[model samples]
Target chain A: MTGLLDAAFVLLILTTLVLLGSSRIRLGIRVLAVQGVVVGAAALLLPNHHVTLRVVVIVLIGTILDAVVFPILLLRALRTARVERETDPPVGYTASILIGVGLLTACLWGMKYGGITLPHEGANPLELPVAAYTVLAGLFLIVARNNALNQILGYLMLENGIFLAGLSTAMEVPLLIEMGILLDVFIMVMVMGVALFHISRTFDSIEVGGMTALTDWPDQEDVGK
Target chain B: MIAGLILIPLVAAGAAFAIRSHPVRRAMLVSVAAVHAALTARLWVDWPARPAPVLDGWLAVDAPGLLFLSTCSALFLAAAVYAVGYHAREDVGEPRRDIEEGGLFFRNEPEAVFAGCMLLFLGSMTGVSLSQHLGLLWVGVEATTLATAPLIYYHRHHRSLEATWKYLLICSVGLALAMIGNFALAASIPRAEAESGRINLVLGDLLANARALNPAWAQIAFVFFLVGYGTKMGLAPLHTWLPDAHSEAPSLVSALMSGALLNCAFLGVLRGHQVCTAAGFPGFSSELLIWFGLLSMAVAAVFILGQTDFKRMLAYSSVEHMGILALAVGCGAAYGMGLHALGHSLIKGSLFLTSGILLAAYQTKNVTKIHNLLADYPVTGLLWLAGFLAITGAPPFSLFLSEFTVGKTLLDADRPVAAAAYLVLLGVIFLGMASAVLPMVHGTGPVDHEPAGGQSAPPGYRPPLTMLVPPIVLAGAVLGLGLYLPVDVREVLRDAAAALSGGVSP
Candidate 1:
């Protein structure tokens, strides 16, 4: 079980790198799908003491959402917007990959020095470090990407990281409560999907940087100043 | 009965998507508001100034929850009423025709989506108030964000699209952090106890075991929760999405977002504060809130000074008032914060509604472009000017009483600096807002004036009666609350404040 967790963690890290290096929205999303599958596998492969029928059910639903439903929605949004590939992001692919490595090193360093240990031994040692990496990489993607689609992908990665952390803690939060939170995210992506369609329709592009038109910068009154 | 709050809105939303007629959808929206308000009133009359579960221990109306529910129900009804009247404009009544980019364009408004989302948004808010479980509360608040995201793009223009994108992205990240915060709060439970299967996210359970829970872990958790929920509440530094969202969203939607949603998000902060207070470190959470509150006020004051758009000015005022509510809550004046929220909602909701009226009549949101409001539309102008006064915490208004109580509480807490800063920021806001509003409300009409939007109404144009009356009704409610706090209300406020400040009950 521990070995499986380690392999899954490595897969998750490699997927994050793929997301950072990829320019095609389609490939980026496919990488995200694989990452989601890895997260689900980690849960299902949990040591017998930590596994439950409800956990299995949740991982199934989560897999469907992160892998199947979300990709279709993003693809539909793409078709509606009539675009296939993302423009070069604000952070170059090379730099973002380096940032990914930096994030992993920092996460491991923090765990070693920062001493944020659990009250007991965690389910897997790599869980915390992998979760931290995914979260930081997600934040980086959100900030460094120019495309709205990439931002959404980043958001999904953030959720993935948080999910990883929870499983590692083996916290006893109920299946029902977890489902309720997941439903909120489900609706959230759906709403953002609709907004993305609307945004692409209006601006004819989904570039986050193109949002400066509505700002209060050098207010209309202070334009000359 | 408690379940009805969540179910009714969901049902209405479904009906809204099914029913295609514009007027019926509008009626459905307002009817849900009415029923929701009636349900809230029943609960208010029955519930005491303490926490008690009514729905199998999953849902409860406590003091703070009741306070927010009342504010939510009232503003929702008022905003819906204003939406009904505002729909009579060309944008809603028929397909809009425009010669844009040198071509003829026509498009029908999505009335059903707008009306349905508003109903669902109200339900999400009510769910937040009635929920006793922290996970449920997070779901409820996040649902509110999702439900209202589409409503921000009601006009379906480039600017509206931009606003919706920013609103969704910034808030989603903020609330996701909040979810991580929830995880942190959960992790604070002792590992042995948690693994032994005694973990519960119910507010009561968490509060009961707070001292046994890890304080350091909870404190760190509380920080994440603050930033996450604080973004939704529009606290300074986390409030970048607010001004655009408020100013771009239709007036009625703006009213709900400012008047209700910010308070709903504040309820999350209050829950975290409750746990911290229980953990024997009341000062830790309270200090965090005070610094954030003060920073929010200063930021709001700076923005309000040079704000040109009336709607945007109202948005910044929301940030300022949200700052006031934070300060009030942090200083241990739960009663005052509750009243301040109620007073602020009524006054500000009316102000936003009247701003809608201004939009309809003057055809521009730009402050300088608006003139002779008092003469051109007497009912709207009086409500607008009165709302501005009431919102600025003038006497003979409920806002004054709440602001005074909040300030007095701050002084009593021996935070003279915070109290003084509160007063000073309020003064700055008033002067700045007065600089924009006074001229618009006082000036006589300028003949042959060119409208900023190129679609200004005739000088004597009158909006529908529905639009004018909601603000009038809201302004009156503000008056009633100022002149008298009913015995039941006073009990609720006192109890609610006591309850929020980590007391058991009366």
Candidate 2:
């Protein structure tokens, strides 16, 4: 069971790396869906088969929503926007992948030096690496992606990493708290989506750079003048 | 009763959302504000005991909590009343309707929704001050951010939208990092103790077990908490979003943000300080706070000196005052620090409210334009000038008393160097702020010849009694605090300060 969890975690990190390296918006969403599935599988393989009914319900609901519904919604948004690929990624795909590799190395090195004891109920070594990789990948997406929609995807990836950290503890967070977190994230995405739609409509471009002109201190003067 | 103080605004917010008529919405807002102030005053008179109604150890009203709550409730009531008058004077068309052709902006009538969200924002801030559980406090803080986003975008101009987006995204990221810190704190608890499992991340619980917490993790957590909450508090290096948001927001909203919201964020940092002190890490936490405080003061001084927009300068002033408050607390002077927080809140609230009036009358936020404020609007201009003096810690103002107290406390503690540095920063800030503000207040530039917003105030363009009265009342309160601290209020400050200093005066 532990080996299965570790394999799933590694696969999740790979999917995250794929997300970081992809310029195609639709492909990135697909990678996120795959990553979400790995998280659900890892959750299932935890040593605590005595998991409370509430934990099961939360995992079930979160997995279904995150892995299936969220992906579909994101894909629909991409299709609506009709952007085939992310042109001029914030950082090139190669650099993002290199940064992910560095993050993964640092995670392993830190774990060795810190020598922090892992939780007894589950696999410990795999936990920190998974979290670090996912977090790095999320940051990559956020920094490299040009579209506001893709940034939201990165935020969700970062959240997934944090969720994995919580799962490593083998303690069931209260259902209400979990629900609150999920609801807040949902509302945040909805708000950002609306803002993105408005931005697109007004600027005639969904690119994040277009909004920079709205700042009081614009870098270029002659464009609008 | 503590719960009622928070719930009333929340219910009023919902009511405001349901009603469409501007008059009805405005009336609901005023009534709620009046009732909130009245209830808080009653609480003061009743002198509620310590730990009034602890909810599963998640919510409690102790001395410091009560002090902040009362101050916030008072300031919010004033801002709410003033908002009605300010809104009434403006044309009720869509805010983005006047954007230049080909400009990147969208306009909509979210005024009713905006008004409703402001009330909710007030409620959430109140919740932040009153909350005992760390989790509840986090919830309240995040809720304030969400509730106020619409209010920030109330103008719906392209610039306003950009400001709102930055405020939302950066603050949310900072807040999320704070949540990770919170989890770190929870994880640091010892597993051997039976009661530790039941520990609910309440401030009291964390403080009680501070000595047993993992010191390394606690230190990391404190750093994250400071950076995270400090971002919201508009501390330097992390305060890039503040001026833009404050400048673009409606004046009434700006007042609340500068006055009430920043203090709530400071409270979160103070909570972390309490935990760190109890955990035998006082020096570490204090040094970090002082570093950030001094940096914030320096940055504000520079920005204020070079500031072009009058509103942006005021925003920087807020940042400067927050720095002073942080420095006072960092000095480990309990009484002086408590007084500084109170004094700053009252005076800053008054200044922002008055600045709103000036902006409304002048029609432009540019510091160079619209001179002879006293001649144009005698009462408001005088109030604005007085507010400037009071905020800069001039003699005979409450801030002067508070700042002097901090200086004395530092000297008594044998920190002459820090005291000197603080004075220098304060002097620089004073000079910078005065250069920008004095011109607008006293210059002989042409009076605002045209009625602002193309609407002549009906027959008599005098500000409504609601808008004019609150600032005057607040100014009076500030003056009273400066000249003579009431016995009961003094006693409350003493107790609160004592609590902060861990019962040690030094």
Please report the candidate that would top DockQ against the real structure.
1
- Cα deviation of B479, candidate 2, in Å: 2.1
Tens digits of per-residue lDDT, candidate 1, A1-225, equal: 678777888898999999988888888888898898998897677552356777777788878878888888877777777666776778998999998999999998987687676555544556667787888899888988989988988988888887776665535766433744476466546787777777777677888777775655435432210
lDDT digits (tens) for residues B1-506 of candidate 1: 77787789889988998897778888888899999999888877775633346655668877788889998999999988888777767444554543222232434347777787888898899999988878788888988988888888776666667888888888988887887777777778887677675757778777778888887678877898899999999999899999999998889899999999999999998889988888888888889898898999999999999788888899999999888888887888778888989999888899998888787676667887777677767788889889989999999999999999988999998888998899999999999999889888886435577556543343556778888888899999999999998898898888878877863433
What local distance difference test score does each model get? 0.81, 0.74
lDDT of 2 by residue, A96-164 (tens): 888888888888888778765443434556676677567667756776777877787887787677666
Looking at candidate 1, what is the lDDT of residue B18? 86
Whole-model alpha-carbon lDDT for candidate 2: 0.74
Let me know the DockQ for model 2. Answer: 0.31
lDDT per residue, candidate 2, B31-140, as tens digits? 88889888777766766355356576567676677778777888888888887787776535644333222444346436578778988987998889888777678788
